[model samples]
Target chain A: MNDSMSTRDSLALAELVELQDVSAVAFSGQRLKPGRGSNLQLSVAAGFALTEQALSYKFDLDGSLVDVDENDPLVQLSLSLVVTYVPRNANAENWVGGDHERLKAFGDSFAWPAAYPFVREGVTAILSRLGADAYQLPMLRPSDLL
Target chain B: MRSLYERVTATLKGARAVAAARLRHEVLALLHQAQLASRMTQSDVARELGVRRSAANQVFRGDGNIRTNTLAEYLHAMGFEADLRLVRAGEPRQAALEQRAVRPAFEDWRIRRPQPTTSGVFVTNEGDDRPVLVRWAATGRTESFRVEAEVTTLPAANSFTPLGKRMFTT
Candidate 1:
């Protein structure tokens, strides 16, 4: 949000150290709701924690669709993302739990926003692969996120 | 400390509920995307679905509890064949992302092998201009490599593993 720092500079400061999944969703027996083409119940969750050398974020994009007519239930589709960005700043470790304006700015303006596209991509790809081409990730204004 | 997932689950509770919450977010996101994709106005949806303009507005802005059929109607009005179905996931939220180095080509030099399975590789510098130093825990030996064009090559640093394309620094 500040003019003094560029996104590129913030990214260069926080190198992507580890990006992986912590929560693996099980969709072994997912099915459509009894009412065909019915409405879907969807959700998204975001949270973060500070590690020894990095800032970590987790995003879970989960959806549940039910067949109100069927006795059997459908499986929920959930994608839990875990991304760790290591701040190469020598003083980064010291700022772990303390109030650090620069760190907060880096996350809000650069690191956190940088992680949005992946979630969007996940939403679109999952829907497309499932043959639900009717939907896609919502449009985002550049200023809205950064 | 409890993991981020566990912590979230502790607060939110119920995988089914969490899944539903995410679905709603995607619904809103997709509705927004659809609205933008066709340049279709809220009035257009209201006209097509035979509803008041405010009704359509509430759904798009996520003003309150949105009906599933209402959302479906919005997409349908926009010429999209949207459906609500739960299918097996073929997607993966990528795992354990790490900084990696590209293989360096040198006649008398060797490249640093990225250990995707191994851990405890230490990077000892802050920026690009500074030389990167790596110290192995078992040997306690430090290896220095000058950073060249964003790629750092280690010559005979480990002397055992192949440095794949992924720069695995665990």
Candidate 2:
């Protein structure tokens, strides 16, 4: 990374277009079958693509809770997100094969740090609305995940 | 006190806001495509519209919200027309319909016509192969909710079908 490319600077130049599919579900007691509570699990997956203009990045994050007892379907929630990122002074015309992969790498490795807060806050807000106890999701860095 | 329905509505509105924010760029990209198609420069469009070069550039850069009339005029200058669409999730595109000046004043102009601030359209300039797609899904006890917005274009210089007219046919 160039000295000029810093997290602060990148975020300053990066413009977020949107976040979608922020949803959550909280389990109510008695809904969960005995022993089924031990199998509860959560998972996160993300994908990134360059916008048509090559001027931005669109990152999608999907998070869900699974393995809830059949009776406790309410205990699970699935979310889908669509995010657009525009990097200052980006040239999409020159982005081909290898360059495209590099850009996706950059999106996974850098853009997440900039966009995670919005995702985290959005998830927090929606879950709170559903009467779920306020929970803190683990903070993840691009290096840690990618 | 807000009911659960109201709370869900508020959260959905927030998601809509995010999608709307993204529309700024999508619109700009469409304008850029129009300019390219017409072989005009920013200066040319500005000069024709009698706006400053920076103002024109700003609109194309998605710097800020644009007025409906201003956007219409700008596209007209480029020989294109902007068609705002409110598409439902999983809806199939119907056969092209004839364009009508038939604006139901009460239902459209009075309550829901295009405005300076809210165009009520989301423009995704991606091509057919790799399209920029936005999808929202929310579940409830019995029913789920989903809707999409998109912008389509046609040549303004020629009388053509309006996208809103075609999709919004009640």
Candidate 3:
């Protein structure tokens, strides 16, 4: 067996990890409504989670032969963001059930993309109202990072 | 009435969309703030990042659906390092065991604890021995100590120890 090649292969295997999906999410913040002139502020926080198998692959760089599963993800990452919206003139509307679900799905496989537009549109609308067009965020694709 | 599966699926979809939107807003807002603070025009950023001015503009406008690497590069140009932290949430027992087994005793330096949001993020001073402190938000539980600072080149091939002895340990 070629010792160097074996080590190289093992390291490559470790690097060949993929992002599966947002396993879970928890966030705290309020919703910004359309048609209301409001100032919005947000803080984005992200975290990472790794399985035991993935951990083994990372530190066990001794070129030792070990079982490798292509289908399993070595790590899971969680992104939590909180957006605070202050209305310029008017009391805030009552919070509803959909808000909780909105936060939960932020980490879900199917719902993340669907919810992106709402925030974008909200920002655009509010900024347009304020006559400030300078702020914008780059669109991010989760799969590409994997 | 909708089927249970159908309802659950719809709800999940709604939640995902909202969460994604919020994340997008936060990221864009931060980038915008960074751009203002740096006072570097889109062209300036493009030159530094080696992209076209138009491409830099697209990123600023939030039109680019950026990949993680691209985002890291953008942040790097602006003098910030993107650090994503992942901590095992449910497995307290496993976390404890790993913590005890892996961490080395060090006094002068300590691994920055993961924040309520994310932790162990550092900005490079751009010194010769730019101490790189890597915390595995996903995998590695241990943070390293900086025993000493030495000059070395990163290997392109299969050399066992990579970048031997820098200002910081990883």
Q: If scored against the real structure, what TM-score would every candidate get? A: 0.33, 0.31, 0.26
Off by over 4 Å in 1: A1-29, A34-41, A64-76, A90-97, A100-106, A142-146, B1-170
Give the alpha carbon lDDT tens digit for every residue of A60-93 in model 1: 5567544445434343455644444443443544
Model 2 residue B170 CA deviation in Å: 49
Indicate the residue-level lDDT of B48 in model 1.
85
Evaluation by TM-score, superior candidate among 1 and 3 = 1
For all candidates in order, the CA lDDT equals: 0.49, 0.46, 0.37
lDDT of 2 by residue, A31-88 (tens): 2222322232334444444433222332333333224334343334434333343222
What's the lDDT for residue A2 in model 1?
Answer: 54
Q: Residue A97 lDDT in model 3?
A: 20
Docking class of 3: incorrect
Question: In model 2, which runs have C-alpha deviations exceeding 4 angstroms?
Answer: A1-41, A55-74, A87-92, A95-100, B1-170
Q: Which residue pairs collide, candidate 2? A: A57-A85
lDDT of 3 by residue, B55-170 (tens): 88888788857666777787778876654433332232344557854232243334464332122222344753332322223323356323322222221112221111111001
Between candidates 2 and 3, the lDDT winner: 2
- lDDT value, residue B18 of candidate 1: 58
Weakest 10 consecutive residues of candidate 1 chain A by summed lDDT: A20-29
